[model samples]
Target: MISIPKDDPAAPDAFPAAPGAPSALETPASPSEVPKETSASLQMPEGLEFYAPNYICLTVFAVIFFPPLGLAAVYFSSKTTEANQNQDWEQAYINSGWTGWLDVFAILIGLAIIYVYTLYM
Candidate 1:
């Protein structure tokens, strides 16, 4: 007679069974009966949607120079307004304005550095 130990690696059934077992593979809940996932829902705040144009412009400016950072700034700033509509428009405007200026400054600085390095080389 052959005996298989519970911890034996060769035994297919050696591992403990999952809780739901075979039922775990059954069909998922129907669309209507399923609890609606609220994760994807957009919950915008009160007044910020109006300044979408500013956000777009900032995003464009960012893309012209540092593509990744600009894209990230555009993404975060856009979401910032969406997450809180009641936020002050003046503040948003100032923040976007500075972000645009910084991107421009970085581009200029990079160009200057490259020009100087080429001259020295």
Candidate 2:
């Protein structure tokens, strides 16, 4: 209130207080007495979290450098994302992990092919 401009007609001198506002002393003194959760505290284990991570995009870009690896990564990423959407956490986790391996394998294979071509062809 002090920081607000006094000259500004839009600003009020003081904010209006709620009628029958409960005082701190009148409020729940004990932590246990105060109801903690306004809503359900625990969620029933359900629903899919199809969150697409940025690595999927990175792996797609890898296609330009290593076609096989990039393709594999994209495949794994798609599989995992689908599983996640289906509420299949295990499959999602497994596929997501494999996507990284695919990207690495693609880079290595691309390099290997280039090396072979340069030496032999």
The clash numbers for all candidates, in the given order, read 3, 0
| Per-prediction TM-score to the true structure, in the order listed | 0.37, 0.47
Q: Which candidate is the best by TM-score?
A: 2
**What local lDDT does model 2 show for residue 48?**
22
lDDT of 1 at 90: 69
Q: What TM-score does prediction 2 earn? A: 0.47
Which digits, one per residue and each the tens of the lDDT, describe model 2 over residues 1-121?
3577789998888775556544546777677675544223332344423443526666865787698679879888889777766556778788888887888777777778889999998
Judge candidate 1 against the unseen true structure and give its global Cα lDDT, from 0 to 1: 0.56
Which parts of model 2 are misplaced by more than 4 Å?
A: 1-54, 111-121
Q: Which ten residues in a row have the lowest lDDT in candidate 1?
A: 34-43
lDDT agreement of model 2 with the native: 0.70
